[model samples]
Each structure stands twice: as structure tokens, then as C-alpha cells.
Target: MKISLKKTDLFVGIYLLSAVMFFIISIPSWLLDFLLAFNLSVALIVLFNALFAKEVLDMASYPTILLFTTIFRIGLNVSSTKLILRDGDAGKVVLTFGQFVGGGNLVIGIIIFIIIIIIQFIVINKGSERVAEVTARFTLDAMAGKQMAIDSDLNTGAITDKEAAEKRKKLQQENAFFGSMDGATKYVKGDATAGLIITGINLVGGIVMGMLYSGLTVNEALNKYTILTIGDGLSSQIPSLLISLATGILVTKASSDGELGDEIVGQLFSIDKVLMMVGAALVVMGLFTPLPNYIYIPLGIALIVVGRRLKKRTGVEAIEEEVEESEAEAQEIRKPENVVNLLNVDPIELEFGYGIIPLADVNQGGDLLDRVVMIRRQVALELGAVVPIIRLRDNIQLNPNQYIIKIKGIQVSDGEILFDHYMAMNPGYVEEEITGIPTFEPSFHLPAIWITESQRERAESLGYTVVDPPSIIATHLTEIIRQHISELLTRQDVSNLINNIKDNNQALIDELVPKLLGIGEIQKVLQNLLSEGISIRDLVTIFETLADHASVTRDTDILTEYVRQSLKRAISGKYFPSNETTSVVTLDPNIEQEIMSSVKNTEQGSYLSLDPERTKKIMASTGSELKKLEDMGKNPIVITSPIVRLYFKKLAVDYYKDIIVISYNEVESNVELQSVGMVTA
Candidate 1:
């Protein structure tokens, strides 16, 4: 491949090289004159570019520019000092400043040069250094918070992953720019100081050389050398000072909008009242004080006229804006409704009323958005499922304290919260209660009380589980997501999971997905596992199991059983407490036999086709046995034979959805289970 450079690149390349050459090789006065002019032009370009750039990132390479300009400026200073001592004339540019700007006065030119140094070094350069240092520190410190905000926006579907990536890139550029600027200010300060030193050296060298070689008297040599030195200093410092000013402006600029001029004008002078008052003050000063009335009086009167006219125009603009808004509203009402927008639905939505708004508003110290992000992460860890973006919105139709959680546009559950209070629930052991508004916990419908901040400490002391409003909403949202995570796992989500697996285990994914089972089939199997509160995180095992058994059976229910049995260790760890005996109920042989006999295997799938009356008896007996386990402070786990486990779970789902049915094949042998009771019909 061949490479080519643009004209701008070549120009910049040559210019920087010339700056270095100027420091080594003596050039003719004309060439020096042209280079000095070129330097001034470049400085002006940089100053304007820094001034008008809408964002600092627009000038992301500014620090490098600063280094280049400083090197070039120092080269000019050195070359001119040599010319002043040897030939007594640097160039026409330096001479023009000496004669014209100083009005033929050596003292005036020297004083002016010193003043420039003071302003640039003590004021502009110093302020820029401080501003850049602080900006860099603050920018770096804020990066973590900005990154999390981007992630939360991405998870909430407020921004796409691509947009988030762009934002992160911009943030990194800003950090780099500010960090480099913090150091770049040093170069400007050093350049100004070096110029001052060079000017002084030139003054001394020129006077001594002129007196000895040119046959000039002491005063003549002093006047001649001092004028040229001041001229050279002025020519160099002017451009250097402009650069310093640009640096200060760029660092202090916070707007990513228009130029500095526009922001200053619009912010300070746009207000009619401020303009009018200033006009009044100027007019009063002109009349009452000894200041020149001719200068102040006309300016004040013109300002007063401008302010009154601006006020009238502003009023007209406001009326025009109202007219435009009314016209827009009328046109909107006349237009046909947008059916496309109405057809789309967010995957998850948490709409609350006005009073509950603060609980979701991040600016008001609410962390509901952060909690929502954590809920997504928690679901991924717990069930190996990606919860869809949860949307937060406010609805005026709801009662002030009410909020509803919707899945696919339909409200599944709702809860009311007193915004300024905490919900305290007894954890079954606390006999003491604090006084508060009585309520029920929305997630579990357990009895709770809404207590004020004053009572929160007392309630916690009494052993009540106290939760704030945001936590309450987050908890309820999490529970709802977990309960419906199975249905939420679409084919796209399954494909995403497969893609994630392909990153490391391509062979397993390639062989298992679409070869033995389609995405829908895989989805159904995963859903089946999720529906039973089993995690599918170990997709390698799940996919490997499917690859082994899917060729024999495509039925999701039967495949699910194979998966569950394959994941017995995980299942055992989940349901059976660690290193402890678990008291559970076992299904009677008659009931297991009946469940298996009633299972109907069709081309679609397998399900229990038990008689309705017999089903009622089975469900009643199952619930009663599970209730006994519950009363014994144990989870409602049922142990059944391998073949009847799936069918028995199906039979019990109509009445006892919370029942945890496991097969003898699905429990690890190390797990100890005590059969406290048996379910018989």
C-alpha cells in the first residue's frame, strides 16, 4: 500500500522544520521578516480557533500545538537577538515596531515590553495554569460517575450501545485534553520568561559591540541598542501574549455552544433591565460628576434608546412565540394520530405518579436508576437471563402516591408509597411495634407500616425490616422481573446467549444450536429451567446436555428434565441448605403412579391429562403436605420418582405454583433429605 499526505500536513511539516532550522542557520533579513510575519499569522489562527471552538475536544490536539508554537517562538527570539548584536537590524517587522509603536522613544518601548511580560506571566499564564490544573483534576474525578451514567442510560434504553460508546470516547478525549493542557501551560510561561531574558542579553551585547566596533559613543549605542531590543521584544511578546490569552479563554470556557463573544453578549447584555439600569447610571454620572459629558452623555443616550427598542422587540418576539405555539397545537390537533408510535411498547415500564416522582428522579437524590441497573445485573447473575430495559415515566392519571409496573404495555402489579416515609415490616420475631401508618409490603403483600424518619430508628431497634421508598420500588420491580423472566426470554435473547457462548466455546454452540435444536427450542428449554427457579448461567453444561440428548428427543419438557438432572449439583446447592438436613415432603407411590399414567405425550409436547376430580384431590393433598413443611420452617420441597417428577409438578402447578418438585435423579447424593410427611390422595 502507498501513503500520501494532504497539503495541510505538508505545510505543517515544513513550517515546524523551518522553525528548528532558524535556530541553527543565519538567514537574510527579508527571510527573517517573512518568517516573523508568518509566525504572527499562525498565532492569530490559533487564538481564533481556540476562541470559537464549541467544545474543547474540537481542539483535542491543542497541547501539541502549544508545544510547537513555543518552540517556533523561541527560535524567532534567538535569531532576532543574534541579528541585533551582529548587524544591528533583525528585520523590517522589528524595526517598524521600534519606530512606530514606540513613537521613537526607547524608554516607552522598553516599558511597554516589560508590561507585556508582567501581564502574560503574572496574569494570563498564571491563571491558565491554575484553571487547567483544576479542570484536569475535576475531569478525572468525574469520569467514574459519567461512565456509570452512560451505562445506566444504555441499560434503560435511553441510549443505544453505539451512542454510549461515542459518549465514552468524547469523555476520554476531554480527559486527555485537560490533562495535557495542565502541563502545556508551563511551556507558555517558560517561553515568555525566556523572551524577557533574551531581550536583556541583547541589550547588553548590542551596547558593548556597538561602542567597540561601530565607533559609536556610549549614549548613542545605548539608545540604538535599547530601541532595537525593545522592538524585538514587542514583536515577539505580542504574539506570545495572544497565545496566552487564548489559553486562558479556552480553559475558562464552559459552553459547547457559540463563540465566547456570543455567550458573553447573550448572557450579560441580553437582559433589557440590566442594560436600562447601566444606561441610567452612565447618564447620571455624566450629568452629576466632573467626567466628560460629551463622551458619556451620547453613549448613555444611545444605550437607553437601544434598551427600550430591544425591550419592545423582545415583547413582540414573545407574542410571536405564543402565536407559533398556538398554531402548532392547532395543527397537531388537526393531524391524524400516529399509529406507529402507539403500536410500539417498552419491554418494561415503571410509571409512577407525581408524589412518587422524587423516588425515581436521580437529580433529587433518588437512586432508583442505579438500583434498576443493579436489578438487571442481579437477574443476569441469578437466572442467567437479561432483563429488558426498564423505563421510568410519570403518569398524571394515577393517584399521587401510586405506581405501577408494566411488562409489554400491560400493568401486572402496582403499589402505593408514602414518599417521605419508610416501610417497616416485622420479620416474624419482633413483638414490639412502632407507631406509624399501617400498610402492606407490595412485593410480598406482607403487613407493614409506613413510619416517619423520626420513627425509623425506633422501628429498626424493634427489629423491623425498614425500607425507603426507592428500595421498595426496586424490590418490587426485581421480584416482578424474576417471576416473569421466563416469558421475557425471547428468541433474540436466546441468540444473544448463544453468541455470548460462542466467544469462548464456539464448537459447543455450533454443534448444539440449530444443528440439534433451533433457537426456539433452546429458548423453550431455557424458559422451562427459568420457570422452575433454576439458573441457566452454566450454558456450557446446558448446551452440552442438549447436544447429547436433543437428537433423541425434541420435546422441551423432556429436554428440560434432562437439563435439570444434568445440573443436579447446582440444583442441590440451590434447594438444599449447605451441610444441613432439609425436611421435605415425599410423594406417595400411588400419587406418583397416577401422575405418570395421566401424562399425555403428543407431537406438541408432554402435559398431565389427569381427571379434573382426581386432579383436585392430588392438588389438595400436595398443598396440605407443603403447608406442613412451611409450618416446620422449611421450604415446600417435594421429592418424587424420576419419571413422575415433571408430571407431578405440572399437576400441582394449577393450585400450588410455589411447590418445588424435584426428582430422585436431580438431587446430589451428598444432600441429606428427611421426609417429614407424604402427599397421598
Candidate 2:
């Protein structure tokens, strides 16, 4: 969720108050101080526990940790710097502030903090691996399969106008409530106000408790005002606003759910009045707090107020009421419960969890046994549990992208085991057992090719197993990889990869230049395929996998040539046909005079012959010109017509012999027309 100004203001307010409370409490003596520290430690323990239990770690606390360290060091500097006035103590050695805290020190601290923040960011950005696992484990009522109902508008039914209105109201409510939770969690987690509250409560409470415990009168405890003031003064220096903001920012950004509440608090409490009140309180308490116990009571109360204020301001209760109304409306829309019987769909409940496969001796033969053993060992070592291997098969064709293999196993762990040797066993086993396996079944026969040590190792390390015997699995694997590689190796993007190789090795030009020159046909095929709506990303992925596999040890030039030839063949066969019928123009002289009359132009004294059918068309067209003249003259002035006159004056007067225009094709060029024209009366 994007943070709104309202949220930011609330955060600022809560932070200010929390900061004051926290700082003030730190100055006072308190019984809960140790408990609070323990709680913080327990929280850390929980977070670390999650790291192992979760597929993805929640990294939000890391930044807070660094920020806390920095602020904590700065806030308590005065108390730390004060030297003890012990009897016979050596004279104090005066030192410059730079010696204790200089520009270099600040720079170093910032860099450390930045590094911690970045590490946490990377850790958190990886999507919740734990969500899937936790959902499976904790959400026992919910099944682990995706909802696959196909929604048709008519059958699914649309929401009623009433429901829609209710939904709007509910959404507004949840947004507000969730926002309130956001600010409250931040204040409670780690801010100076929390500390100040602890300090004030602890101070007053401690004085009371100490008086009770030591049998000192209340007046005696009151006499230690100077000491209390000193402690409060030290506490006041701790910036409650800065600490709260830092913590809130960390929690907001780090939580799996976006920190809506943090933003809300930051916005609400950021006003000058709130800051002034909180700041003044922190400064006063920190300087005056003698006993720590009194600080916490006030700090806790302040937090309760901060939280309550945000909740009230945001109107979360109203929102919840509104949401309840909406949900009720939605319930009315859903059809009354109906028992729909399903056939041939006995679903098995599968529990899924991340298994960390420890590396065995990679030098072991990259075989099925070795791979399975490696996976088993790794799982055991990581979880401090032994897992039973359900079954193992070899030569299975899995996804080309990841050497995915289905391993049916259960984790049983309460002890530590070694994993280093497990990884080492995969490559060695691949060479011995996996490569030369023979055909397993009638339907699953396949081919075997040279497998790179790295490829074998990668396959084994990932616990990939062939589901079928060697021969049968080989064919399936080949077909799968072939389909993917064929699509990928023939793409336009491949040209970019080619360019990179070409710059370093001009030999590529000699290798693939012919293929490059003749890529137009292949490009045409790809376009046709694209037009047919084949997925481009799928094509790219297949090619990228092929390229990655090739990177294992294949000759770059040879692979390039191979891809080019394959593409050339696919293009030639798929789109362009070599033996296609050539279109030709043909003319029948028998209907020439009749056809010529249609054009309204036919005046011919002689005809010419030309090679091929094309020349015949030209000659036939000329004869039509004479017919055109005959048609145009209503009086039938056959001798006086311009076309007839031109033909007779130009051809009949001069060279009575016929001329034939013969060109490339074997069509006769007016030869038959000339023969007829010369014999004409």
C-alpha cells in the first residue's frame, strides 16, 4: 500500500511520543527493563527461527537493528563518558571529541548501517517462501491447491447494487483499521517514547518500590532529586522522533504486508503541536528520572494513548461496522449450499516444504543413486532430521529451466548432520551410472549424448532424476530439449548473442555469415509463427536454456553453425516451398479478334512472333487494336480509318516482311499474326 499523508502524520506523532517514553524510561530504574530486553531478544530469536522455517526470510527488522545500534550509542554517550571518581583513580586523560566521535566515525557508522539495510532489503524482497509453507501448516482448514473455477458472467452472477454499496463501506473500514494497527505496532516495537514511558514509570515506581524495600521514607527518596534530574537530563538527549520514525520505517517496509499503519501514524503525529508536547516531555523526564521503574508505567500509558488516538482519529471501529455490513450483504448473494458430487477426483493432500540439499562429494559418479543419496543427506543435515526416500527413478525429463526432480520424502530431524560431502558425490555418479543407461521401456526409448561434467553435477546437485529407464527417458529428454532449443536458437534475440560473440571472435562471421545472410526465410517463418500466436517468452526461454546448456562446454562456432542450419531447414520446410507453380499469362489466338473488339482498339497490318507465352500475349493484344478500329467506325471505312491508315501506310508501304520479337521465354511473338496479315487481301 502506498503511504498517505495521514499515515505519515500519525507515524510522526506516535514516533515522537514513543521516542520520549523510551528515552525517559532508559534513564529511570525499572524492574521491567530486564524483561523488556528479554522480550526484544525473544523477538530476535523468533525472527531467526523463521529464517530456517521460512522459505523466504522477513528482512524488515535488520534496518531497525542498525538504526537502534546507532541511536542507542549516541543517546547514552553522556552517561558512558562520565568517569568514575574512585579513590586513587588515575588523573583523567583529556581527549578531543573527534577522538571519541569524529567525521570518520560517523562515516563508518553510516556505511555499516547502509550495508545492513541493503542486506536486509535483499533478504526481504524475495517473495514470502514461508507464506506457502505456513499456509499449508497453520491454515489446516484451507487446502493447498489453487482455486481453478472458470468464471462465466452468467453462471458466476454479478454483485447486487446493495452488495456493491456495502463493499465500498467495508473497504473504507478495513483500510482505516489496518492503518491504526500500522502506527500502534511501530510505537510498541522500538521508539524513544516507549523507552521514556518505561523510564518515567520505572523512576517513580522504583522510588516507591525502593522505599518499600529499603524501609526508607518517601521523603528520603524525594531527597535524591539531583540524581533523578541527572538521569532525566541524560535521557532527554535521545531523540524520540528520530528513533520512532526509524523503527516505524523499518517495520513498515519490512513487513510482508505493507505498513499502512506506520504511514498513518507518521502523518497524524507529525504536527508541530504533537512534536512539541512529546519533545518537551522527553527532555523533562530524561533529565529528572532517578529510578528506572517509574519510567515504564508512564511510557506504556503513553503508547496506549497514541494507539487509541490513531484508532479514534481513523474511525477504525466505524470501518469494521461498515465492513461487517458489507460481508453480510455478500453472504446473501451466494447461492444456498449445494452438494455437487465430483467423479474421478480423489484429491490427495500433499504437504510441501523447502528442503535444503547438502552437497556431497561431487566427485562421486553422477548417477541416480548418488543424486538421491545427496538429496537425502542434505535434507537431514540442514533440518537435523533424516528423511525417508520414497522412491527413485532415472532419466526423467523435467523443466529445462531448473533441473527439477520430484523427490518423495519426509524430514525427521532433531540432530545435526554434515552436508559438504553430499554435493561432491553427484558429478562422479553422473559419469558412471546416468550417461550409459540403456533403453528402459518400449514407449520411453531415447538417445544419449555427451554430458558435460558441469551439466551432470548440476543435474545431480539439484536432485533431478529420470522417471524412466535410460533408453526410453533419453528420447523424451531429447524431444523436450530439442523443442525448447529449436524455438530459442532461431529467435531474433539470438542475433544479439551472436553479435557479442562476433566482436570477440571474427571467426563467427566465417561460421555463421551464410546463415545470417539467409535468415530472411527463417525470419518469415518466425513472423508467421508469431502471427499464429505462439508465445514469444516461451520461445526465448527455450533458446536461453539451450544457450545456457551449451555454455557448459560446446564449441561456440559449431553451435552457431548448427543453430543456423537447423533454422534454415525449418524455414525451408515450414514456410518456403522450392517446387511451387509459377504463374504465367497465356493467350489463345482463336478468340483474338473477338477479344480485341472489347478493348475498342485493334488495327494490325502485321504480327510478330516472340519466344515464350508472354510474347504471344503482346502479339495477340496488337491484333486486337485492328479489331478496335473496325468496331469504332460506324460507316465501316476500313481503308480510311486512322488505325488502318497508320498500319497500311507504315507497314504495307514499307517492309512487307514480318518481324518477330522473341525474348527470354519461348512464347511466339506475333509470328502467326504476321503470317495471316501478309496473306490478307
Candidate 3:
């Protein structure tokens, strides 16, 4: 049998096992010296690793390393203390360190040992402990916000699921790593205190042993034991100091893109002007003050030379970079595939100017992006439309406060707003007046006043509808979306909606989709409903109704009418108030007959074919009735016979693009309708 042990595993096992072995069994001085040297090398390696790592999590097991190394160092201290007390010699490593550092002087070695203890214990270890504590606390607190940012990016398609998963994993590891470090810092603190206590014990116990067993004089024993204790102290404390310094550096290091040395040099000397100013100041100090002219003048001149060279190098690099960038851009534009990328346009875009950027920027406490997200949800719920991702960007050409909304890359509407002002509009009942800047509400084109924050309370108290800039923008955006939603509905959108239904109600989709009507036809029917601001959330009912009627007539217009009649409840709820009589206009019977008679049937579908003179008279009468309804403060609704409803709607769309033309069958029995006027030709 062959044992195949990995080097890392075997090394770690021996290391940990040796820590225990030092406590259990006695080791010779040669092995102790070798272990002491190995310990120093490991400590140096840890310090270098911590210094160069770009991210703290790159050494996620640092806390565990601290634990294992502290234990091993303590074991070495115990073994060395035993050797000094029992045998008057620890090792050549400890003896040489004490003699070389002390220069064969007793007091200097002790003083040096104490100074090391003070610096490590008071400065590095204590500061590292606090930093680790704060870092762990902050990491735990920020986890939620970071996770939300990841989710927001995922929703916006800014990052993939894989990237998000990796971010989440890194976040979790950061949390655990810092938490472990918070506790691990305590080990280093205790190790320092333990080293101090064990050094005292070795000094006192060595003096007693030397006097009684070696028959040395009190002075000889004191000098001999003191030197050995200081040696042992220096040997152990030096490594401990290095370990604490590593901990301090690791915890205090801010995240950077490169090694510690490189980042430090790049940032400290990046500004040539600062360097030149410092060099000039040093020269002045060297000449005018008591500071050494030999050292300062040469160093100052060297810095000045380096500054000039760096400045020239930086200027050359900037010019070269600019030239490279322009050439690369020209090459990119000439590429056929890259040119094609420029032609693609966003479906919906909200582009503003520089002045409005703060309102759209989340870091500046702007909720416009959040409000936009909510608008998508609101539209989906109310109109059953999957709104495309809305693109937001700043335009330099427009006025500072002006914003433009674009649909399929065409500018449709725009509005200007004041940042810190409120828009106050009287909802028809406010008798009180307030001093404010006069404006018009962009959404409804109603007269409004831009009032200061101070006047917002009084405006609301006076029964005026007070809104902020963000609400004004959101409302305008919602209205624009509602008006163009029909055109925005695409075949892909219809397919997604169909697939939603197919998830649970596959039978209805399979029957109505391709068997009776294709996706394009279904899209038209849905668009017809959306065009009139009808909710299509009830896809099951709509698809079932389509299946029942699609077999009879494949014409989308007639099929839309059938679907509308099937959704009478929703239609009535949307257009007419429940348990209330709504005043509307009724199409005259003569005009309804004329509309049906002139309907022209083609292979594709049926359309109204009334002559110009007759069509003019019909539109005039329809406009007159709509005027009467508007004057009476009623919605401009026209009720017609089910057969003529579709034709009349198509004919009047040119004149009243937002006209509500419904058939008698499209009204539920619960809806109370009062005919206040008539449309006659």
C-alpha cells in the first residue's frame, strides 16, 4: 500500500501536530533553532501575502491562519521557556538574537524587548481589532442594500444570473470573513500578553536555577538569565510583532486594483505639481532652516528631476491615448457589424437634459427610476401590457430643464420642470388664490401653478391638487404610455401573453391561437382592446371568447367586437360608474343603417366605404353630439347597434382619435346609461 499525501495537507498536519508535540515531548536545541527560523519565514510570508493581495477575501482563511500560527508560536514560547529555566540555554537562534540586538548589554536587550511589546500591543493589535469589528458590522448591515442592487441590475438586464450569483457568493464570504476576523484579532492580543508573562517567568526561574544548580554567583546568574530571557523575548516578540503588523495592514487596506507598493506609488505621486511644490519646499527648508543641506538639497533636486520627467511622460501618454482612441473609434464605425448596432433603437425612451440628471440619478436621492419601475407594474395590471425596458439618457441639445419622451425613437412629447417647486392645480373647487409661477400640467394640459415648498401646505389646504416634480413626470409618462399602448403591443408581446395563459389554460390557447386565428390576429384584437384603454388581464376569458367566435369570422374587427361584448362587465366598469346613470350620445338609427349598408367586404376584412359627402355629414353630426356630451360634463361615448359599431368606430377615428364607440351588447345590465344626445346625418 502506498500513501499519497498532498504536500499542503501533510505540511498543515505536521504543523498542527508539532504545536501539540512541543507541549507534550521535549525537542533538541538544533530542531528548536530550525523551527524558530521556519516560524520567522512563515511570518514574513504572511506579511507579504497580505500586502500584495488586491482583495481581503483573496485570503478568506486569514483568521484561521492567525489562529494556527498563534498556537504554534505559543508552543515555541513554552518550549523555549522550559529550556531556559531547566538547561540555561534555549537555542543558538534565541541566544544570537539576544546578544546581537543587545550588543552584549543586559539593559538594552530588555528595553528593546519592552518597546517591541508596546508597539505591537498598543498600536497594531489594538487598532486592527477595532477595524475588524467595524468592518464586520458594516458588512452585515450593507448586505441587504448590496443584494437589492444586484436584483435591480438583474431586473434591468444589466447583469446575468451567473454574475449575480457570483456577487452574492462574494458578499456572503465577505460577511463571514470579517466576522471571523473580529474574533481572531482577540487571539493576537492575548498572544502578546502571554509572551510578556512567559518572558518574566523565564527570567525569574532561570535566575533561581542558575544560582542553586550551576553554583553561579548572584551577579552572574542575574546577568546570564536576563540575557537569555531577553533573547527568548526578542525571538518570539519579533515574529508576534510581524504578525500583528500584518493583521493591521490587512484590515486597514482599502480595496485597490494593484499591489500595495504600486497603488501607493501611483496615488502618492500622480500629481506632478504636488511633487514639484514639495521639492521646492524642501529646497527652501534646506537653505533657510537648520535642516541638513547635504541631505535635503540632494533629495529635493532628485524629486524635482523626477517630477519633470514624470510630467513629460504623462503628457506624452495622454496624447498617444487620444490618438489611439480616435483611430479605434474610426475603425469601429467603418465595421459593418458595428454600424448595424447603431441602427437599433429603444422601444420606449425617456431622455432629458443635464439639469434633470440629478432627478434621474438614484445616488442623488432621486426616485424617478423607482417610479418608472412602478409604472411598468401599474400598466401591466391595468392594461395587461408588458412594457419594454424604458431607456433613460441625458441629451445636451435640449434645454437644461426640458425632457422629451420618445416612442420607437420618435419624439412624441416634452415638458419643462422646476426642480424644487410644486405644481398646484385646482380640481375645479378651490376658491382661494395663491401666488405662484403660472404653468400648464403636462399630462392633462390643464393650467397649474408652480408653487414653492412653503406654499405646498396652503395649496393643499385650499383644495388645490399639489404634486412634486417626480409625480408630474410620472403622470405625464403614464398618460403617454396609455395613448400609444396599442401601437406598442407587438407580436412577441402577444405571444408572451399567450404563453402565460398556456401555462395553466393550454386548451384554450391551442384551440384559439393557430387553429382558428394566428398570433398576429390575436395581437390585433388585443391591440383593439388596449387602444380603447380596456384591461386584458382576463386572458382566459378573452381566449375562450375568441375560441367561440374565431371559427365564425376570421376578420379581426368583427372578432374584436365579439371579444368586447364578451368582456362587457370589464368595459362597463372601466367607462361607466357602477350604480350611476352615465350621460352619453346614441347613434341615430338612420346613420347606423347607412353605415352597415356601405360596409365594403374584401378578401382580407370588411371596411366602411361611405362616399365623401355622406361621410362628411356623418362626421359633422358625430362631432356635434360629442360637443354636446362634453358640454354636459359627460364622457364622449356613442352607443350603436352591434352590427354598425365597428364600422362607425373606424370612420370616426380620423376625427376623434380617442373616441369611445361601443355597441349596445358591450354594456352590462348593471350599468345605468342615459342618452343625452343623438348623432344624425
Report backbone clashes per prediction: 0, 145, 0
Report the lDDT tens digits of candidate 1 across residue range 49-97.
9888887877889899999999998888888988998999888998998
Encode model 2's per-residue lDDT on 1-681: one tens digit a residue.
Answer: 996578867864654454345444333223223322433453455444333221112332433444444344333322222211111111111111112222334344334433433333233321222222333243233221111011111111234335545645544443343333343333323333334343455346545654765565776654332133223322322223233333333333322333445455666774544644664565466557754636744664575566557556568667988999999989977857545642322111111111211121123422323433344355334322223322322112322211222211221211111212111223223554444333222222223233344455555555544332222222332233222333323445445534545565565344434433334333333333332222223233324323433434343322333343333333233222345422222223333332333333224223322233543454444445444433542111112221122222223223222221111122222212111121121
The ten-residue window of minimal lDDT in model 2 covers 146-155
Q: Is candidate 1 or candidate 2 better by lDDT?
A: 1
Q: Give the TM-score of candidate 3.
A: 0.67
Q: Write model 3 residue lDDT over 544-613, tens digit each, in one string.
A: 9889988888888888888899899999888999878998899989888888889889998887789999
Q: Estimate TM-scores for all models.
A: 0.90, 0.22, 0.67
Predict model 2's lDDT versus the native. 0.33
Poorly placed runs, candidate 1 (over 4 Å)? 4-12, 20-28, 79-89, 143-169, 205-228, 363-365, 434-436, 548-552, 588-594, 641-644, 664-666
Clashing pairs in model 1, backbone N/Cα/C closer than 3 A: none
lDDT of 3 at 653: 90
Q: How many angstroms is residue 185 displaced in model 2 relative to the true structure, after the best TM-score fit?
A: 18
Report the candidate with higher TM-score, 2 versus 3.
3
